[model samples]
Target: MSALPGLDDCVHCGLCLPVCPTYAIDRRESQNPRGRIAALRAIEEGRSAPTPGLLRGLDDCLVCRACESACPSGISMEGLMMEHRSRTSDARSDGRTVAERWFLRAVVSSPGVLDRFLGVARLGRSLLPAALLPDTPGPSRLRPARAASPPAATSRLSTETKGRAVLLRGCIADRVQDRETRLAARLLSHFGFEVSISAPGCCGALQRHSGLVDLARELSLERARDLLSGEPDAIVVDSAGCGSALHEPLSDAPELHAVAERGTDTPSLLATIGLPPPPHPIPGPVVFAPPCHQSHGTRSTEATRSLLEHITEGEVVLLPGEEQCCGAAGTYFLRRPAKSRQLGERAKERWERGGRVKTLATGNPGCLLRWESLLRREPGVEVAHPVTLAARAYGLESEER
Candidate 1:
């Protein structure tokens, strides 16, 4: 039997159990990191085959990597899990539906196609279920006027330019969260940074989590080439998931090392550049839900909090369960609706307990969408990226309706 790579890294210390969301939810050993690693070791040694139960154990994982943060052994849990998924072809097929596969392979991989489909989805939104439509019909102002332009070189250096960054207009972000994307660019530019918006299509984070490793690799390589073609000071990503995906180690494409090294979340980038005090500090408390990718995956929890604090004059409350997964691990909500809702409800309950807050800011698009679905009916409670709030504080009005 062949050895599973990185399986030996886990020392069975049980440190990951308490922080594991699935374990916290189910109280099952199989749902925890140590147990999952043990199971992977067993399979590698031919002690077990990939059974339905085993697959369920693996699929149920949020892959949020919170456990990795807690692990004392410094295990590369994400890499191990992805490698396992990549090796198990059957797992990929079983985890995703034909339609899901088509969407990732065809729709998401091409920005123009996805934009067209979303436009039609918007028209028929009233006819569709609440679950099918986005929390709000995206502002008409945000709809892409045309397909995203290709990744062409844009050298807009000025003596005043502090740095240069290329914005990743991800597939879903390009359509649904266009206002945030635009605001992020505006804010960066305001800070004396040259900003170039590029269509890298999708970052392949969704595909990797869905067990479509082949597609994930292909998309990663393509994005690496597109983003790294010309040297930029930073590759700015507003979505935590996209930023983390871009940061994933692409051993095959060593050329991308520089780009991956430069990849940063929007909030972190602002922190590095030094956020100027908001011209008009937004009134009332600002509650932040740090996405798992940002908090746990990238370890930018403190940096995110600092940025939020700098932008709002009111109390900046880090939501109590900031480290917990919001259950919107990319398409996890759509794939495992029951668990997703359970976790999202728990997160919302935590937010509610935090007292009256005017706005809720988070780093990931999926987290924003999930919260919007939950809070859209609540009235006056706005949810957005922290950078959006910062942009507003800097006197930039949202073009959003």
Candidate 2:
């Protein structure tokens, strides 16, 4: 009981209950944060075993941390959930758990394997529509293989140069988000920053979100060390989930914690140093889905809005139920496709109301993919990262680096 976060601090005020998606679905006490914490306490205190019912209750949680925003006691629900999962998750208990574990530990976390895996997915998408497949992550993004380096473009600044920065190319993102990664690099370079791509790697977000803490810790430490090796002034990750995960205290290792502190999202870092007024305006109205990680975890919504407002001509509308999870809670959709779709239906509802909007921008890759999957039938609507939109507005894709 003492080992779990928020166990001792919980006031049981039930502020988190209404925001919990699983609880909303089940309406069971077992599905909410307070109930989950009680289960953790019972298990830790040896008053109850981690039985299938209790474990299932915990497993059903999205870990989206939607509840954290409502907590008055300042409880770290994600921290408690991750720690609980780290100790209790049993891979051998069932085949589903085993497969999910294998995919994250063996496939999604390995850059080479992830690329090949996505290669197979891209092949699959070539045969049929990716929208028919719930698990394939934004198949449209896997463009023909190209050079990873940013084009050598001239900077507008002559004397006021920004310091060097690194862009983390994530595990699955190495393939799926390659263009966004390149666009981000191109934009950062165009913005007067000397940017370098972090070597292909996993930030352990998928793993950590799934409760595989030890491996997440190891992977985070390694990636953090690698990101820091170049001595860059900033490590800008365009992926919200990855940026938020970078700050996760996956391990108690001081070095890992130190390296984690330097990671920031493109908008947050860009907002700090500022940018030249965007020469081109994003066409038409834009609808934005701020990722739960950004809104609830890092609290970078203002910075994200500041950067969005810089490049757009029209209103950047927030999706309805902005507090809700997209159900892409790292590979959660893969495990529970129907429930994931249920969770993501809110975005679709808002998309229907967002008439005349061509671009649906989001900060996180998962949310982008989620929106892509949810709104695929509306081919006219383009789903993109905010940085991708910013990069396009700057015409960086056409300019030579």
Best by lDDT: 2
lDDT of 2 at 214: 80
Poorly placed runs, candidate 1 (over 4 Å): 91-97, 129-146, 149-159, 398-401
lDDT of 2 by residue, 331-391 (tens): 7887777777788775577667656367888877778778877777776888888888788
Instruction: Report, for every candidate in turn, its global Cα lDDT versus the true structure.
Output: 0.75, 0.78
Worst 10 residues of 2 by lDDT: 143-152
Point to the candidate with the largest TM-score.
2
Error of 1 at 238 (Å): 1.1
- Backbone clash pairs for candidate 2 read 151-401, 152-401, 153-401
TM-score of each: 0.90, 0.92
lDDT of 1 at 321: 66
> Could you report the Cα RMSD, in angstroms, for every candidate shown?
3.4, 2.3
Once model 1 is optimally superposed onto the true structure by TM-score, how far is the C-alpha of residue 70 displaced, in angstroms?
Answer: 0.3
